[model samples]
Target: MTLNSNFREAYRQAQSQDVIGPNVIPKALPFVGGGLILTALGVYGGLGVISNYPNAFMPSFWVALIAEIVLFFVARNVAEKGNNATATPILATYSLLSGYTLSAIILVALSTSGVGLPGIGIAAGGCGITFIAARQIGSNLSDRDGMALAQTVQLGLIALIVVLLGQLLFSLFGIYTPGWLEFAISGIGVVIFAGMAVVDFYIMPRSYKDEQYLSAALGMYLTYINLFIFILRLLIAINGGGRD
Candidate 1:
């Protein structure tokens, strides 16, 4: 499981050969811009529950989840079909979904008790780091060597284990896993997802032909989705689900 070699090679490939089209820039810029825009809207929509209709805030959680699911398929289909134009919209939809999901989790934290300052701080810090990483990945207007075959296979297995463990833990407790355990799980999830981003970034350009740009967007979307979900779980862990 190695990334250094493949990642460097991918970089060289980009430098020596034009793997992307001119429309890649035009298509990708909007993905970045639109992602940011939707993120802002989702954040506002989810967190705007400072007063008035507090109960109104709850539905946004489901809305965000459903939106993510929809966009996932849309992006997958577009890439399958070689439609680069759909890239920006797909990214935008996923970004909004992420912002909305985070907003819901933050609301959950506020609604619950016993979370305290330390928990909030840790969650916030992790989330900030994840956000920055997302930006770095999205702005990767170029590609290069990617994860080795071993690393790619390992990441897939790790992701599967993490997801299964998370589900089992949740089912057992009827909620998120408790305390530092949750944070550890989430932290690992973030790292794995980040690795997936690098792998996907390289895979898109190297594997797909006409759909290179769209595939890039899809890879970036998956990265964000995995990162945000794990980070949200980490926050829930710190919060301790109040008295429940």
Candidate 2:
């Protein structure tokens, strides 16, 4: 049988089980944990970047946005062709290239602002470890056969609507959220990420080919990254202990 056929059969077996379905849970964990880590990184990275070299940092934000859009299409094509393994490697390459922007932000945060390097380092280390763990766990599941084109479009729309609406509300208020609110945001973000991970993990294996692993990885990576950032923001907002 072709890899695609094998992938479908395996997923069928995985889907048949009880208890949240093996096909679903592994993906769920990473989305929650990963999103928290990424969110934290984004906050620190943005703050750090703006603090050290304000101009360079902000532009990368736009650039990262564009890159994500490009990759989204690439991932979709790769998955349609049954190339899961290839998808992840390609995504890693993009991530490596794109990561520099965030790294620049991180460098600025740590070196320019001496707020608390040790604490940040500890948190950063923990986030990295968690990501590695999640990737490994989720990868163990059988491959997804492929999602319907409509489902893919629907998922993208859901993400866009949520993000745009959330940001709009925040922007309209000009509300610098209070410190305690951070925890609440983080808690909510965790729940969202967990659900996202479950959805992605279940969907990816069935829809994507082995060559599309990179694409799936990218999807997984973003989910975790978002989660991380939300968690981090919560931490910073709260830990500051009642901002000025």
Candidate 3:
């Protein structure tokens, strides 16, 4: 997803910084947790509308998706200026809308046999596991190792985006991705974003000053959410396209 195009900006800024904000991750953790909670609430609300007011779901979903795109850029801009009071709410709202738009995928997971709540749980759990490992390894990286990993992740992201665009263009022409290709793409996405989880730790401290924790939070939130998304996609692909 282009949802994290903002991260490239963060990565660019990280290259120039010689100092790291050792406290930023600790400070940003609460907001990350809060944003995620809001996201869950939004998902709950979206599921209700989808279940009970099916006719409105698609229209409302497109609006929410567009709003999310707008809010993300606005929040990042404000956060970069250190306007925490303004940016915090915008990021929160963006998180909520993000979950709302994700309802369609979650609904598909819910419908697939042997891949309902368990699949969702597993995807979420996978992100939590990634965070634990990333925190340890990402924090202790030698300077050379850190730079090398960052370069690898950057190239991976660029290549992944190109493949994804190709997939989208083909779908628009009624040439949807075959099941095996879908599985392969989603699996690669899982690997790429898992690498990103590590990079966020190494990059955030270098990219942001103490005042810009919201930006860090936004980046961290994007990492895990995208991880969640790709994991869910992998699950759906593995289960044979959400239904028989």
Candidate 4:
């Protein structure tokens, strides 16, 4: 089916548009905030290790990266099964590991001439702004608008994943994306995740029932994290694309 038709079929029956889980968003918001804070702590710790014991940083980073990937699937599975007790620590660890891996980009941003702390702040502020706007827009969307927008962003996300995979493959061969392509990729990433920030507000209510708040929280956290990464990437691309 065409995207619009598919959305129409899927969401037409979900006519209420009211959030399925009234408590989900409220409960998830706190966890989301806590997760981000933990991520910041992880980044701080990672930065220290990288600066003082640079050799140790790479091995530790790889371990953390692998663990982070594993934890994501583990936590997601537990959360979806409504095992919040089991998922909570797993998700927290995932967030911290995520931040540790992210420190590499944070390091790049820090070293870039014009994309230092201020750029990080801007990227963060952008997410905050997007959240506020999306909450308003996505929460009130009619079934049609909400589903259409969600599907569009879903397509964008799939495309983004494929592109990122391609970039990773090239990197393995020591071929980094050029400055111009970096701008294109980063720009597209920023746009797609910004769109996802909106879609999350719409999808959560329909996708997760009231009891699945932990799963909902994980979804929101991923959206926020990806959005932050892309915005930071854009800043780095603009200021000093080839430097890193």
Candidate 5:
């Protein structure tokens, strides 16, 4: 079946159902936990590889980024089709590949004087708080309101993509960015992704059935990863400003 049809069916089921079918959180936790563990392993392995062959970092990052993009789309397709068996492994692969890409940034932060531990700590703490608050807000939202929030988040995500594309182009052309502008952009990213996380969390229980745990887990995992990246970037910007 087409992706649209899959979504429509899921929506219909959500609208018709009253009780949140079997606690999704319990089933989802294992996938989330396992994905995170793999991600950590990937990141540490990436760091080691990069340290041993400094020149490979850029190439490795690009390769991992491309792999992640492909795997993400595949995983989404599988999950939307309710193929949890296929989706689970694909999601795990995407998470690991993402960690490989992220290791480059982590290395940069570590190399920067006085920006290592403190920046990581702040970003991790911020993500934790954001996740908890988002869960509370999502759980309280009615189904209709949660759907509305999801639409708003979709638009926000599109705008964020455009902004990120612009940044990429500017960087490609070696355009000089003001310190404040860089900070502002990163701050905006953090806010947008945090909001997206809230929407994702809110919609899972409302939109997905209990058996669609893989789909729900994938959505949450993506949000968490993006949130961490944005928060890390924001901290890095703050640290850079302090130095300047």
Candidate 6:
């Protein structure tokens, strides 16, 4: 079946089911909170380790990135199959690793230019505001509307992927990226991730069981991290690239 059709079926199924007591949001909050805490700890720990042993950056980045990817898929699969016990730990680990990766990027930007901290602040504020607005908008959307928004966001993501690949190819060819192009790509990333956050929030109410809150939190956390990274890059670009 087509993606839209599949969405419709899921929506229908969700609508038909009798929702039990204790809403998904409340159940999800603790997991999300815990994940955020772990993320902060990971970022701090990574920064400390990287500061003391600068040589470890590349290895740590690769290891964290790879481990996070693996754990995310495993956790998602387990969550979908209703194995919350296993999924929760995996999700937590993924979040922690993600934070570590983020710290590396932040530190790199800081070392490169003075815009780093300001960029981070702006990104955090933007993410907070966007998330709140998106959640409100999502909570008010009908399932059909939510599905439509999801499709639109998916298309945006495809465009973002294209931009990313183009940038990668440019880098591989040792071509100099124009400042305008860097700014544009980063802007697109920010917008796409923001839209994705909205869609994610919109679908969450109907997507998972209360017991699967960890999975839901994981989704939100991913969106937030992506948004932060894009925003940070955009800010750095505005400040004239990350170069001393």
Tell how far residue 130 is off in model 1, in angstroms: 8.0
Q: Hey, what RMSD does candidate 3 come out at?
A: 1.4
Error of 1 at 23 (Å): 8.6
Which one is best on TM-score?
3
Candidate 3 structure quality by residue, lDDT tens digits, 1-244: 4356876787788777765677888889899999999999889989999999999999999999989998988999999898999998899899899889888889998998777999999999999999999988988887678778888888888898899999889878888888888888889999989999898888889988888899999989998898998999899999896322
Q: Per-candidate TM vs. native?
A: 0.61, 0.53, 0.96, 0.91, 0.85, 0.84
| CA RMSD of all predictions | 7.1, 9.3, 1.4, 4.7, 4.4, 4.7
Sliding window of 10 residues with minimal summed lDDT for model 6: 1-10
Q: Which digits, one per residue and each the tens of the lDDT, describe model 4 over residues 1-244?
A: 0011122222443445566766677778889999999999999999999999999999999899888877887887798778988999998998888889889999999898899999999999999999999889878888788877877876776687788889889989998888877888889987877777777777777766777787878877887888888888888888874534
lDDT of each: 0.54, 0.48, 0.87, 0.79, 0.71, 0.72
- Scored by lDDT, the top model is 3
Instruction: Estimate, for each residue in 1-244, the C-alpha lDDT of model 2 and write its tens digit.
Output: 0001122333343354332333433433443344345544555555666678878865776776577556656754674465656554444434443444455434433443332565456545645665565446444434342233224434543554465467558858885545565456555654555444444555555544444344344556665555444444444544553233
Question: How good is model 3 by TM-score?
Answer: 0.96
Candidate 1, residues 121-223, lDDT tens digits: the string is 5654664575466446634634323334325535554565756667677779777444666566666766666665545444445444544555545444445
Ranking by lDDT: 3, 4, 6, 5, 1, 2
Model 5, 91-124: lDDT tens per residue? 8887788778778777767776666968766776
Give candidate 5 misplaced runs (Cα > 4 Å).
1-22, 241-244
Cα displacement (Å) at residue 7, model 2 = 18
After TM-score superposition, the amount by which residue 58's alpha carbon in candidate 2 deviates from its true location, in angstroms, is 2.3
For model 2 the local lDDT of residue 157 reads 37
Per-prediction backbone clash count: 8, 44, 0, 0, 0, 0
